[model samples]
Target: MADNQYITIMLQSLHKKEKVLNSIIQINKRQKEELENPSLDPDDFDKTVEEKSELIEQLELLDNGFEKLYEKVREELQTNKELYKDEILQMQGSIRALAEKSMEIQAQEARNKQLMEQKFASVKKQVREIRSSQKVVNQYYKNMMKKGYVEPHFLDNKK
Candidate 1:
């Protein structure tokens, strides 16, 4: 069954227990009230006694019923308690696995970012060096042409 369904069933069992306990309490209260003030008239006294006896019998029957119900509920609660424990353990295991996976992913992402940054810095350095070399080569070519050590490429191509 689903977790929520189990929880709902447990709640219903608790509600049943509360109702049964309240009924038992009310019955005891009534019995106490009757005992507190006995009937004085002989005829009324006989009638009261008969009514009390009937009430006692009914109370005995109710007590027996309540005992059986209580036992059943107790057994059910014990079984459910075990089931709850198992479910909690399962949830804990799942959470731990998820946490481990998250940590691994985060670590991998961090390493990848670090590697990317290093590569970018290396590329920038190489670009700066290439630009500087290009400038030096251009200066050398211009000086050679002015000194007549080499003909300008444009003049040679025109010839």
Candidate 2:
């Protein structure tokens, strides 16, 4: 009876962890979109990152709880595999889904990284152009404002 209850609790925990992973995948997709936006909002992207962090922490907690429960019935479950076959199968499916979601997140984040690098390169080019133009303007001003003693020319009115 106790082992069955433990299996049920473990299944519930796995479901919660899988849900969090799915949410994180969605957030990563949203982040990719934000990066692609012409006018990217840093705050929004940062908020999503913060949200992802919290979810990751929740995942850790879920994992710890799940591990503790599994330890309680580890010997029994291992010996009586057929006893809780249905719950075990469901948990396996949840694990597979989590893995798929994790892969999706990695791919999305890789794309987002490329986009961020491109944006940074663009900003760098603009900064360099502005600085170059500023230097040219300063040089022009210096040349125009340069003061020196001018050679005097005496008028000769001898006819």
Q: Considering every candidate listed, which one attains the maximal TM-score?
A: 2
lDDT of 1 by residue, 1-159 (tens): 444454444444444444444443444444344333433244653564466456446545644654555454555546677756654454456446545644554564465456546655766898999999999998899787775366457545563
Tens-place lDDT per residue, model 2, 51-110, is 989998998999999999989999998898898788889989988887898788788878
lDDT of each: 0.53, 0.87
Q: Which portions of model 1 miss their true places by more than 4 Å? A: 1-85, 147-159
**Candidate 2 local Cα displacement, residue 91, angstroms:** 1.1
- What are the clashing pairs of model 2? none
- RMSD value for candidate 2: 6.2
